[model samples]
Target chain A: MTDDIQSRLDSIAPLIVDGSPHAVALGLSLKALTPGRAVMGARYDESLIGDPDTGTLHGGVVTALLDHACGMAAFAGFGAKDTPATLDLRIDYLRPAKPGLDVTAEASCLKSHGLVAFVRATAHDGDPDDPVAIAQAAFMITKASKLAQERARRAYTEGRME
Target chain B: MSQVLIETLMSAPYVARFGVRLERKGNELTGVLPFADHLVGNPLIPALHGGAVGAFLEIVASASLLASQPLQRLPKPIDVAIDYLRPARAQDVYARAVVARSGRRVANVRVEAWQNRIDAPVATLHGHFLITPGQDDTAAD
Candidate 1:
C-alpha cells in the first residue's frame, strides 16, 4: 500500500513543483519522495544573494525551501490527496550557505492525525551533517484548501493546466 | 540618512526581484510587496505563496532593525516563527515591524502583514537577529 502511494507521489512530484510559480521562479526541483519524506533542491543563483559583500544567499531562500519541502512531506503523509495549508512554521538558521553551492532540504512528517500534520526539515548546502537551517511546521487540511484542490483537479482534467 | 538606508535595503538582489519597497518617515518603516504573477503559490485559490509572504516578513523585520539604529551591515537572522492567520490574496500586501528589544548582539522583532484591512493581518512573524553596532568614524580609526 505504501509503495503504491510512493509511486503516486513520485509521478506527481515534478508536476506539483512545476505548478507553483514561486517554486518555478526559484528553480526548485524534487530530488526524492516517499511515504512521509521529501527531498527538494534549490540551485545557487547570484540573483538571490542577500549580502553583496559576503555573497551569501538570503535566509529567505532557506526559509522558502524548507517550507516547500515540509509541505511536500505533509502532503505525502496525508495520502497525497488532500491539499494542506500551512498553519505555522518555525525555522532556525544554523549557518550561512556558501556562495555558488546548491541547497537541499530533507523533510519528514512526524505525525498526522485528523486534519493536522507535523513536519521537520533540515537544509544543507552539501554536507548533511553541517546544516544551513532547520525547520518545523504544522499543516492542516482546511475547507478552503479542499475546495482549492477540487478546483485544481477540475482544471487539470479540463486541460487548463500543463 | 534614512532615505539612503531605505534605498540600500531595497537594492538587495532578492528584495529587488520581489519589488519590495520600504516607505520611511522619520524612524518608522513600512514594507510594500506588489502583486505579481510570479508570486503566486496556489493558482487555484490564487493566493500569494506562503514562502513569499514569509520572506517579505523577514525583510521587513530586518529593515526595522536597520532603521532603528546604525548598523555596520544587514542583520543576520538567527531564527523566526511565522503564523499563517489567513490566506494572503493575490494583491498588494503591506507589513510593519516592531523592534521589541535590541542589545549589542541580538535583536528581537515582531512583524504583521495585512492585505486590505489593517485590523485583520494575514500573517505574523517573530524573529531574532544578530546585529553589529556601527562605530563612529573617529572610533573606527
Candidate 2:
C-alpha cells in the first residue's frame, strides 16, 4: 500500500506544483513525496519579509504555505481524483521565523473518514526539533468530475501531460 | 463615521500599509481592504490569499471593538481564531464585526468577510482582546 501510494503521488507532482502560487512566488518547491505525506521547502527571500526589526516572515505567508501543503497531503491520500477544500485550520505560532532562513513543512494525513480528511503539519526553519508553527487542518473532498475536467484543460493549456 | 476608529487604525504604522478603510452605519462597523493584484493567492487562480483575509479579520475585529466604545481606548488582540469558509474571489473584500462582549479586562468580538454578497461569508473570525481601559479617554472630544 505504501508503494502504491508513493506511485500515485509521483503522478500528481506536476499538478500540485501548478496549483500552488504562494509556493511558486516564495520559491517553495516540492522536496519529497509519498502517499499521505509530502515535504515542501522554500528558500528564504527578502521579498517575503514581514517585520524588519525581528526579520520575521509574515504569518500570512506561512499560513498559505501550510494550507497548500496540507491540501496536497489530503489529495495524495485520496489515491485517485479529488478536490479538497479546507474546512478549518488552526495554527499555533511557537516563535517568530527569521528571514533569510530556509523553511520546510512536513505534512501528513492523519485520517480520512468518509468525505473529510484530517491532516497535521509542522514547519521549521532548519532544526526540526524546534518548529516555528504547527497546524491542524481538515479538508472536505468534493465530487471529482468538474475538477478533473478543469485539471485536464489546464494541463493541456500548460503543455503538461495529465 | 466614527472619527476615532478611523484615526486610530490609520495612525498605526502597520495597518496604514494595508490601506484599510473604516465604514460606520450607526453602531455597526465595516472595514474594507482593497484588492492588490500582488496579494492574489494564485496568479493563475487570482483569488484573494487566505492569509491576507486572516490579517484583515484581525484588523477589522480590533477596529470594531474601538467603534463600539467610541469613548474608550482600543483593545489589543491576545488571540484570534479564524475559520476560512470559502476562497475570497479576486475583488475588494468587506468585513463587518460585532463586539460580542466587552469587559474591563477582556473583550470578545466576531468578524465576517464577504465580497458583494453578505449571505455567503468567505471567512469568519472570533477574537479575544485584552483591554486597556481609560486609554482613549485622554483624547479631547
Candidate 3:
C-alpha cells in the first residue's frame, strides 16, 4: 500500500507545475520533489522585470514562487495525494535577486497537525547560504487528490482552463 | 499625485500582465484584478491561483506605498505576509491598501482583496517597503 501510494503521488505530482497557468507563464518548473519537500525554479526573464531602470525582477514574482513552493510542500506532506490550500504565507526579501541567474525555491513541510500543515521555504539564485528571500507558510490539507484530478481534467479535456 | 503614482505603477510590465487597474479616491485606493483564463489555479474549484492572489495583493500594497509618498523612484519590498481567508473564485478581484506607517526609510502597509462583495475579503497582505526620500517633499505635493 505504501509503495502504491508513493507511485500514485509520483504520477500526479507533475501536475502542480503543468496544470497551473500562472506558474507556466512565469516559467516555473519543478526541479525536485520528495515525500514532504519540493523545489521549484524560474529563470530570469526580461519580461518579468518590474523596475525598468534597475532590471530587477518584480517582487510579485517572488511572492508567487514562494506561495506555490509552500503549497507544494504541504501537498507532499499529506502523503502527496492531498491538496493543500494556503492559509498564510510570510516572506522576507533579504535582498534583490540578481537579474541574470535562475531563481529557485526549496520548501519543506514543517509539520501537519490535524487539517493544517506548516511549511517553510527559501528562494535563492544559486547559493543556499545567500538566499534572496525566505518564506514561512501554512496550508489546509483536505481532499486533494480528487480536486487535483478534476482540475486537470477541466483544463485538458474541457479547455476552459486549470 | 495619486494619478502620477498610478500611471507609474500601471506602466510596469509585471503589473500590466494581470491588467490591474487602480482606482483612487483621496488616500483610499482600490486595485482591480480582472477575470481572465490565465489567472486560474484550480479549474476543478474554478478558483484563482493562490500565487496570483498573493501577487495581486502585493502589487496593491506596493502601489499604495508609491502613491502615499513623494518618492522619485519605486519603493523596494522589504517583506510581506499574506493570509488567505477563502478560495478566490475565477472572477474580478478588488483590493484596498492602507498605509499604516511611513517613516524616513521604511513604510508598512496593509492590503485586502475581495470578490463579489467588499465586506468580505478573500485574502489580506501586510508588508514593509523601503522608501527613498525625495529631494523636496513640498514640490512632490
Global CA lDDT computed for model 1: 0.89
Better of 1 and 2 by lDDT: 1
Q: Tens-digit lDDT track for model 1 on B1-141?
A: 233444566787888998998887766789999999888888888888888999999999988887777777788999999999999999999999999999999999999999999999999999999998774323322
Model 3 share of native interface contacts: 0.75
lDDT of 2 by residue, A80-154 (tens): 356566777776667767667888888998998778889999989999899987888888764432364366557
- Better candidate by lDDT, 2 or 3: 3
Q: Encode model 1's per-residue lDDT on A33-144: one tens digit a residue.
A: 8988999999999889887778888888888889889989999999888879999999999999999999999999999988999999999999999999999999999888
For candidate 2, the per-residue lDDT at B128 reads 74
- If ranked by lDDT, best first, what sequence of candidates would result? 1, 3, 2
In model 2, which regions exceed 4 Å deviation? A1-4, A15-17, A143-150, A153-162, B1-29, B36-49, B62-80, B99-108, B128-141
lDDT measured at residue B27 in model 1 versus the true structure, 0 to 100: 64
Superior candidate under TM-score, 1 versus 2: 1
- For residues A1-162, could you state the per-residue lDDT of candidate 3 as single tens digits? 657656756776677787778888888999877777889998898878777777788888888899888888887787765677888999999999997788999999999877889999999999999999999999885465357655665555665542
Better of 2 and 3 by DockQ: 3
Residue pairs that clash (backbone atoms under 3 angstroms), model 2: none
How well does candidate 2 match the true structure, expressed as C-alpha RMSD?
4.6
Kindly report which residue pairs in candidate 1 clash with one another. none
